[model samples]
Target: MTTRSRTAGPILLAATILVGLMAGTFFIFACAVMPALSRSEDRVFVQVMRDINDVIQNPLFLLAFMGALLLSAAAAWQSRAEPHRWWTWSGCAAYALVFLVTVVVNVPLNDQLASATGSATAARADFEDAWVAWNAVRAGLSVAGLGLLAAALTVRGRR
Candidate 1:
C-alpha cells in the first residue's frame, strides 16, 4: 500500500471506533441509566441526568466530535486516490449525518432540559417525551454509523 493509504487507513479505523463509542454511550445513557433514574421517586435520577448533561456539554465531547469529523474528512480525501473510495466516503457521510442530528435535535433538547426546573415529578413528563424522541433518532443514526463502519472495515480488509 502507498504511504498515504497506510496512514489514512488507521486514522479512519480510529475514527470509526470513536464514533461507535460515542454512539454506544448515548444508548447506555439514554436507554439504561436515564430510564432507571426516571423511574425512581428519589431526586437521584434528576441529579444524574443533570450531571450527564453537563458532561455531555463538556469540551471533551466537542473535541471527540471534531476529531471524528477531521478523521472522516481525511479518509475521504485519501480515498479519492486510493482503493475502497466508496467505503470511506460512505462512512464519512454516515458519521456526518449522525453529528448533524446530534447538533440539531439532541443538543437543543438537552439544553432545554438543563434549564428546566429540577423537580423530577414536574419535569418527568417533558423529559421523558424529549428523551424518547431524541434517543430514537440517535439510535437510528448510531445503527447506520455502525453499518457504515462495518462496510469500511470489509473494504479495507479486501485491500
Candidate 2:
C-alpha cells in the first residue's frame, strides 16, 4: 500500500465520525424539532428557536461542527496520492457546502429570529419556512459528505 493509504485510514475515519455527528444533529432538528415546533403558537416557536440558537453554541457542538471541516480537509489532503482521493475531495466539497449553507442561510435566519425589534408573530413568519428548507438542504449535504468519506474508507487502498 502507498504511504497515503496508510495515513488515509485514520483521518478519513475521524472525518466520517465528525461528519456523521453533524449530519445526525441537523437531521434530527430537521425531522423532529422543527416539525414539532410548527404546531406551537408563533410566539412559542420564536422563543424556542431563539433558546435553541443560544444553547446550541456550546463547546461540544462547536467541536463537532468545526472538526467536521478540519478533519475532512485533512482527510482530503492526506488522500491526495491515494486512488480514492476524489472521494475525499468530493466529501470535503459537500461539507464545505454544508458549512456555507449554515453560515450563509441558516445563521442569518437565526439572527433574524433573534432580532428583538420584531413581534414574535412577525419573527416566526419571517423565519420558519426558509430556515426549515435550508436546514434540510444542509442536513442532506452533511449526509452526502458522510457517505463520500465512507466511500473513501471503503476504497482506501484499491488501485
Candidate 3:
C-alpha cells in the first residue's frame, strides 16, 4: 500500500476502536450502572457518582474518549483526498455531536453533582433525573457514533 493508505489504515482502526469503547461504556452505564445506582440511597448514590466521576478521569478512559476525537479527526483529514472521505467525515461529525452533548449537558451536571454539599436527598433530587436523562442521550449518540466509525472503516477497507 501507498504511504497515505498505510497511515489511513491505522488511523481508521484506532478511531474505530476508541469510538467503539466509548459506545460500549455508555451502553453499560445505560443498561446497568445507572439503573443500579438509581436504587441506592441518595448519599450512597451521590458519593458513588462523585467517586465515579473521579475514577473515570483516569488515563485509559481519557485516552479512549479524547483519542477518539483526535483520531477521528485525523482519519477524516487523512481520507480527504480519497473517495471514502465522507465516511470518515460523517463519523467525525457523529463523534463531534457526542462531544457537544457531553460538554454542554453532562459536564455541568457532573460538576453540580460534585459540588453538592447538602443532603444527598437534595443532591439526588437535583441531579439524578436530569443526569440520567442526559446520559441516555449520550449513550444513544455514542452508539450512533460507533456505527458511523464502523461504516467508515468498512468503506476504507473496500478501497
List clashing residue pairs in candidate 2: none
Q: Candidate 2: TM-score? A: 0.94
**C-alpha TM-score for every candidate:** 0.81, 0.94, 0.94
What pairs collide in candidate 1? none
Candidate 1 lDDT over residue span 68-98, tens digit each: 7678778778778656678778877777877
- Superposition error at 13 for model 1 (Å): 1.1
Q: Which candidate order results from sorting by lDDT in descending order?
A: 2, 3, 1
The prediction achieving the highest lDDT against the true structure is 2
How well does candidate 3 match the true structure, expressed as C-alpha RMSD? Answer: 1.3
- Reference-based lDDT, residue 3, model 1: 84
lDDT per residue (tens digit) for residues 54-150 in model 3: 8998999989989999999999999998777887888888888878888898888899999988899998899888888877887887788788778
The ten-residue window of minimal lDDT in model 3 covers: 150-159
Q: Which candidate do you rate higher for TM-score, 1 or 2?
A: 2
Please give the distance, in angstroms, between residue 138's alpha carbon in candidate 1 and its true position after superposition: 1.5
* Pairs of colliding residues, candidate 3: none
